[model samples]
Target: MKRRTLMTSALALAVFAAVPALAVADTLDDIKARGTLRAAIDLGSPPFGMQDANMQPTGSEVESAKLLADHLGVKLEIVEVTSPNRIPFLLTNKADVVVASLSISEERKQVIDFADPHGVIQVIAAAPKDVDIKSVEDLKGKDVATTRGTTNDKEATTQAKDANIVRYDDDATLVTALVSGQNNIMISAPQIMNAVNERRTNDPLEVKFVLKVNPYAVGLRKGEDALKAAINDWVKTDLANGKLNAIYKKYNNVDLPAEMPKP
Candidate 1:
């Protein structure tokens, strides 16, 4: 009877020991254990993530990542990604979370999960405020600059059939071309549009026409409920406390919508 009892007690201890290993399998636990949060951000996209006048990284997304890392109680390791590779980096374990301006879509949902939307991005045709681009017809025979593999690319390639679409790998390159007078018209968000004006005062850019507005959210891996729930809660708390809104306004120079769209 004593031998049988000892065997059962050993078996129970073994099972209990395995529980912690299983718990740590979640990405959230892994991040904590690693003592660093790998946040993927697209530094090329201003107001989201970009360098300041001193070439130091500073933007809404950069701050957002900082907030997230703070909440996680871990050090932040920014994994810079372009629009095309953001999702890939997350899926391949190169990043633990994607805080880039990743627009939530049914198509993207099919691959990975997203937390509640933190903000919205408007895709539009923009040019110098002096240029009158009242309609798509006004874009005829013009060169349109846009970042490749982005919703902007899809919108421009689909809508502006007559214009020559010039695609770059990222927003920074595309914006540089615009500021240098290589392309007068381009598809971009209000954040980038405003950035253009700050850099090129002579030809202040303005939205010619809006293409679409999409709610952007943090990207997480599918089946990682722990990580997803943590981010969702973080977004909810910060959004309610006005921290997220304050950060958004500080960089984007605009307030987040009063009624945020559902993710």
Candidate 2:
């Protein structure tokens, strides 16, 4: 009876020790066995993730996802997502990773794990060149446009307290409102403002002032330490090789930030 009890206790200890290792192996093995890495991304946010004229996904985030897939020796599959849906997709196992321009935040950290930042984005106030806005204070009493439920909208609301904020469903509509004179100002990503300017033949829009600098990273399901470590390794290696900067330049027409955080 004594020998049996001792063997049972030893077996329990071994199982407990293996639990963490098994949890770490699950996601990596599933991804490899499936032979494809499904990357969730927003298909309408230009310069980070968007559908080009051909209606195929293209941009910095898409390229980054492709790089990750290549690194893993797997085929790449893109799953379109909105900002609010990005986390849900991961939680539901609909995507292996989210490569959208998801900003790192304390609230988000509660639900998912973020790899080392792949890039940085600045949220800014943009207006037509002739508009005399020089700062957030200048937006008082002016009509401002930004996508609903986004950091841009929140910042614009907080900083330009007296401004009339027009919330649109997506970046495309927000840009349209600015171009059509429905809004005199827009709070958005700098890359988004540049994308809008590239499409216009008239007076182009320009960033007035930056509201916030956000670090963007790949989102993984919670507790996937092995996958997170692998992604961080890839990001660090790419940063060292100049591959990440090349991808940023291809879509943003600028180099990656000089002070990007190291992995």
Candidate 3:
């Protein structure tokens, strides 16, 4: 009887030890208590997130970040991040979340979680209007430029057979290459191409073709259920009430997407 009771007690203790402990609590609750939600944003890209004349961050993405901070009832802290460092920033806790124009990819899913898709973008190829380029096949053995460390690079590499791919950190360098006749063509987001065209109407480049379409989303650390849930809820509410759509249209001539889909 003594041995049986000892075994039973040991089993009970094992079961008790196995009980799951919820150590990390709700992100929204924690943010509210802390009074600040740090959002890592890409200030290099225009019409999404960029610095103004006074060097203040302002754009559709910035406004969305502000709205999210407000919804969480905390102050908004914006950290300017680049394409290469955005994911790392979130993983290292340098920023609580990311609102960069981060495209959803299977490779990235291994390291971070993404919110619902907020924007749909297409990879468009452009060159001088006088050029006779008509399709992706025409770029064979030619050089193509795109923003470094972006979805555009992924698609460009896959679609452009036997083509030399050059990547720049931002639009300015990519555009400069094409204008200076250093590259045969340039590939980037359609909205960004449109912006470049609008800025230089007199010397505009032509879009030859759209390679592929993808969606952009906010990113958080993987396994952070609390943070992911809070962002998902916030996105759903914003999309349903037309807040998300309005923000995009208000900032640029592009129309807002009808719905925010899961990427």
Candidate 4:
């Protein structure tokens, strides 16, 4: 009788212990109970997430976040975060989820769960208005500038091994280097290039030779199966309902792919 009782007690304890992690018990639940869902984002990347001249957060990710929060019947809170800090922010419970422009990668999958990709971005070469550069190959032996610690830097280094690939701490400095003639071409996403061109009156910089295509998704902490599934299901529904495409089209001139890439 004691053995049976102990087993019962243990099972009860196990069930109780799982309360904090249950899909019905996680931050998603807390948000439903408390009535607000907070998200973390990198505000520097425009058309994805960024502040306008009025300092209000506006972009594809931001609008999607708002839509999700609304669908969940909760208020939405925005937390500013950088690329390097996104995982840490989610892991530490600083945010309920991350709507940042985080790339979905196998390496990252080991640490965090990713939702169905909502958009695709690519790294390409951006050159001055009159520069004769035609492709990534033309960048051979020329100077290339890319943002430090980004996929841009890695791709640039690999494609232009002999070219001087300089890394800047931020996009601003990288563009500054390019505009000042310290670098010949810049490696970055077309969205970022568009942001730069918006500020420059001298016609938009030309982009060419797409190096790599990156799909972006919302990120969640690992081990949150319920939350992950819920978020994924929500994304799928949005896609089916045409809500996802509308959000992306509202912010970017580019269109999003209809389905997530296969694993």
Using lDDT, give the best candidate's number: 1
Question: Which regions of candidate 4 are displaced past 4 Å?
Answer: 1-25, 170-184
lDDT of 2 by residue, 166-252 (tens): 888777776676666667678889887876777664878888888988888998987787888889889888888999999998988
Candidate 1 lDDT tens digits, 19-75: 744653488988998999999999889879988799887889899889888887899
| Candidates ranked by lDDT | 1, 2, 3, 4
TM-score list, all predictions: 0.86, 0.85, 0.84, 0.81
Clashes of 3: 0
Residue ranges of candidate 1 with Cα displaced over 4 Å = 1-25, 53-55
Per-residue lDDT of model 4, residues 181-253, tens digit only: 6765788888877776776546567786788888888888767666677777778888888898898888778
Report, for all candidates in order, the number of backbone clashes.
0, 0, 0, 0
lDDT of each: 0.87, 0.84, 0.77, 0.77
Q: Which candidate, 1 or 3, would have the higher lDDT against the true structure?
A: 1
**Candidate 3 RMSD to the correct structure:** 4.9
Candidates 1 and 3 compared by TM-score, better number: 1
In candidate 4, list every pair of residues with a backbone clash: none
In Å, residue 103's CA in model 2 sits off its true spot by 1.2
